[model samples]
Target chain A: MENKRNSQTIAEYIKNWSRKHSLFIMAYGTGCGAIEIPATLTSRYDAERLGIRGAATPRQADVLLITGYLATKTLKRVIRVYEQMQDPKYVIAFGSCTINGGMYYDSYNTINVLEKYIPVDVYINGCMPRPEAVIAGFQQLQDKIARGEADNGTRYKENLEWYRANQHRVIKNWRMPDYNW
Target chain B: MAREKETTLYIGPQHPGITGNMMVKVKVQGDTITNASVHVGYLHRAFEKLIERRNWLQSFTILCRFCVPEPDPMELTYARAVEEIEGREVPERAKYIRTMVMEMARLQSFMLWYGGQSGSSGLYTLGQWSVGDRNYLLDLFEDLTGGRIYHMYIWPGGVRRDLPKGFKDKALKTMDYIEKRLDEYDKLLFDNVIFQKRAQGVGIIPSDKAIEWGVVGAPLRGCGIKADVRIDEPYEAYDKADFIVPTFEGGDIWARAQVRRIEARQSISIIRQMLDKMPEGEVYNKVPNPMKWKIPAGEAWAKTESVRGEVGFYVVSDGSEYPRRVHVKGAAYTNGVTVTEKILVGQNIADVSFILNSMGVCPPEIER
Candidate 1:
């Protein structure tokens, strides 16, 4: 029993280590903050050195970087994209808009609290955070993964009903496919 | 040999190749697009409605968000509109500073376009090089204004502050560096055969139909017509500066690219002239307190030539602290929607994003 437990811990450590190193951010420029992503990933900041690269489709992406203020229209798509991302996925909410709707806090279209609908592992607060801040946020996420504390995906599954209620409240049409997970 | 059935393909509100949060629904027959329509509002923040609630002075903060890549021009247009409504004369020195800032904005925005255009065409090197070099310009903006992206430096009466110490020399040096780099870009991008073949014949907009469709700025000039807000209206210190409005004849992506390339060079020269002819005086004319400031009951429209095209702001005041209404007439509204859909039809499926970039279809400006 002791030998089996020790091997399981080693396997868990290996899995977390690999996951922490490769974070494929979905290349969905949802809002204004999308502009900074190129700056962060490109030559000057070079986010690739830290193992953060853009994944073209949601199915392949491991991280959903919600760039900025999401209108109710975009929130539906964001939920769809988040659900499509594979398991062990993480979210880094960028800008104050994602945190508390930033300058658009009172705007009728944008939601104030992003966490109400989706679980966020990190929040980088700025009207639009600089590339340095974005890189730092990724580092924080990497650290969380290393410590095995970045399990918001499981939390999302556990409270899927509550999250769906929040999503449904904003997205009135409710045309999305049912979550089977 | 049966006729291929047309299929509908949705390009994005989330796709990478797209400029921003907007979608294009295209009907394709085999590899060629037969019909196209643009769907916007993904990035809409109800800017016009929000501006109505804020007082005259406070509304400047929100104006800059209309266009993400270039915010200075939005501020300039709104400031010009407010100044017109109240008949507030900006200081001579402030006019020159405003002109310089606008030119700087044009340069950086064109840099972004260079990346977008080249990236869309599979030339990833230019995107990397241009966006990386764009940091120098962003550094200049950060030094002048407190923020990198959103610079609320231009206000109703005048600028927020005078040029900082050693700013002129630093700006001149940056210009020199950029001018040198533009040659390298020419060799790398303009001279390359693949880019030439891809851009030369694609996305053609005839000169006769361009004005009717409300195409303005570089894309208009690309159609062989000579029209520019700076040359035609001569706002700010543009009257004081000597520069020619560059025009090209192809009416295609290549012509638009060439128009921008020469305009970037012209902008550099214009900035140099503004610095040379700049008068020493106060940079700002202080308006009344923000909470109590009210404009006389009137309306005004102001226009400025941004990198994309002519960006105009119309402001209506009701003799109250808040504006009665605010409406933005951005070039993207016409180009991104009507012109984009019109041009995308009959083009190869691969060139949708390519043509969109060449037209400078900024989505936030469209939705805002």
Candidate 2:
């Protein structure tokens, strides 16, 4: 029913997403790409218009946005934030780090893919995707929300587990594609 | 009884309180932080341990990741360390380019800090302007180093590559634009009344404590300590470039922010000198095959003034193709962990983020 309504009414869909957009986001900046995350959330990009906000506490956040490469050490925090977030939440993996280990593939300590540890609904591609791209990722998350695919439910939980099992397989490290670098 | 009374809060191994990879346990009574134990090694894939396995040249790329925010200093310090060990002199031209790139990174780092520090105070306008202005500089870094943040451009021999044509002119023009925007921020952030009230008397540290605690960069400078690696111990083109190290006597958040603002203006001066007295030569000296270049067995401590504070790399090589160990004796350990916990004790809950930003202690740097 939600999908049908979303497909039928795009304007109403956007309005609904906008109304609840003040998503408390975890700072969660891990790599070189983090420099731009600040750029996107601020006035120039104005992530607030969509209700996207950076949250100091995960319990308050509606979105868990990961910007760029996250080391294994950082991965634990990502999980904690994901756990703290309310059930009806969304996760967007920004830039190369969140999608795939952009440059740190085969790095001694880095986790090549983020999907293993946390449930990510959307992944934006770029070495460090620009602030413009971050906003675009947010809009796509809203659209996904409208479609009801991104709603926090049993489905998102199941997908998070699936990705964790295949985390290494999902990310390719050219240094040691087959393993044992 | 004490443990039960204290509320334990975990900050970064992945928490929003600290940026990057780090987790600290803080026990707070009411909103005041009481006890803090910083737990690094979250991001420590053992960078110091790994450096021993890779050749001298290939190790450069890995070192920059240690301090992701202002990576140029890592590259510069490592290169200088290697140069010191090898007794290789960087060409005059390479020095100019290195100076320019380093200053550019410094300026961008300050701009980014301006946003984070002010935003922590609930001053969003600084966040808006500083981050936007920083992109203009990052664009320059992107053009110069090919990578925006971790420019593996600075290396042991000298630098990885020379400036592309018109880069000098473009960088100078960008500096002018950044200077104009700083004035706008001065009005919005520096001169604003709210920032003053929130940050003025907060996080007071004495000069003796600042030195004892190993506070370098802006925090040390804010406490009226002119402990800048660039001025006290000049490296690269720092000796040639004329600029003043800005300091403040307040020893508070406002003082630290002021030092950064003043330094941003001086970074522009250094960049202009780099361009005006630009040397003409190759960017890098002859570095051996990256996969097999062994550094001679020795220890070299190279420190550079990053936007945050003194960023230094301590490396020891065992006459192998790789380094024996590489340890960082930088600002974050003291500022991010020890001092952050100490000063946050009596402050309000709202000042936590602001205090962290003002100190410019990125958690990953400390944790790594």
Candidate 3:
């Protein structure tokens, strides 16, 4: 029992340390907030200094930064992207649209409250949050991961039935493959 | 070995080369494209339908989203359309400021173009340099309008606020800095042999088919046309300033890039002229209270020369607070879709995003 417990502690420490050091973001800019992303990632803000970088593909990404409002069509693609990402994944829902859909709340297309369909680990508030706010949000996510409080990816797996039901209801066409992983 | 078959590939909704969230489906045989289709609707938020629901003043907020990189043109076009419908007269100082803002947006957008075009071709240093330099303009915008990307500064009657003290000095200093940077950029990007070798004669848009395909902005200008809304239909303070509409003979990627580079220089000169001749007057002419405001029934079309090309807005207002219909005719509408499909045929698969970048195709505008 002591040996098993020690192994678990070592695993936790390594996981937390690695998670805090590197964050590969698949910045899906579905709205106006996408414009601020290049500013944050590039030399001016230098998100690389904090070990945050952009991943070209979802397969290699750690965090899915849903930049702004997600239209129904984009929401389908976002789900596919999220499912493709590896385990220990995170979702950083940016802007007011992800919270309650902001100005696009009444729009027929965009989904209100992204957390209903996906487990959002952090929410960055703004009409379109500035680069400073984005950096802060990343900091918060890093802190959460270090504390091992960032277990939403596991939560997603446990509540897979609920998340899938909600996702299927919104995405009408439902052409994508099943998220079994 | 007897027969060559075409294979299909999808480049997008998350592709690095693509500026935003649209996909391009290409059928290729041995690295050469045979047929192409642009799969948009990834970033479509139904802006037209959404605008119909919001009131006149409120609709301005969403206009900028039509094109992310250069948003002031969207704001200006929408504002001008409403102003014309209302027969509102803008103050002289406001006109000059609007002109300066538009020119600033043009300069910053060209910088963004440099980053995207170079970044796609494995020359990431240019992307790093240009995007880093673009922050200077963003800082100016943040100080002036309080938003870096979405500057909701322009309104129907006039701009939201007047220039702050020492705004001109700061703007001139930035302009001077940008001028020096432009020369360095020409050496780094425009004059590079590798870029020239890759861009020259690639993704050629035939001059004869330019009009039929509805190509506008740099793509059209790259085909040796002097067609510019600022010259043809001068709005704001464009008529007040003297500037040339730069054009090139070849309609390839290099030619388009050249057109953009020359236009960036012209924008600098225009901004200088605008600042020097700007009159001292009221910045804004306030409209009615937002909750109770109403616009009379009228239809108006306003077009402005955005960094991309001609950005036109056709707004129909009913005798109510909300618009009857707001149709944004973005330059990228035809460029990103029809022209992209037509031009991608028989070209190299690697140059897909290069061509798209050259055309200044903003995917959100295409989808919206």
* Tens-place lDDT digits, model 1, residues B1-368: 97547898888976878998899999999989999999998888999999998898777778888899999999999999999999998999999999999999999998898889766888888888888888889899989998888889999888998888999999999999989988888888899998899889899998899999999888999999999999899999999999999899989999999999999999999999999999999989999888999889999999999988999989999999999999899989888899999999899989999999999989889988
- Candidate 2 deviant stretches above 4 angstroms: A1-26, A30-33, A43-52, A55-60, A68-74, A94-113, A125-127, A132-148, A156-181, B1-3, B6-17, B20-26, B39-42
Choose the strongest candidate by DockQ.
Answer: 1
The per-model lDDT (C-alpha) reads 0.90, 0.75, 0.88
| Window of ten residues with lowest summed lDDT in model 2 chain B | B12-21
CA lDDT, candidate 1, residue B13: 75
TM-score per model for chain B alone?
0.98, 0.94, 0.98
Better candidate by DockQ, 1 or 3: 1
Residues B263-331 of candidate 2 have per-residue lDDT tens digits of: 899999889988999867777787767677666778888888787788877888788877778888777
Better of 1 and 3 by lDDT: 1
lDDT of 3 at A159: 88
Error of 2 at B8 (Å): 4.6
Q: Considering only chain B, what TM-score does candidate 3 achieve?
A: 0.98
RMSD after CA superposition, every candidate: 2.9, 6.0, 2.9
The DockQ-derived docking category for candidate 2 is acceptable
- TM per candidate comes to 0.97, 0.85, 0.96
TM-score of 3: 0.96
Off by over 4 Å in 1: A1-8, B1-4
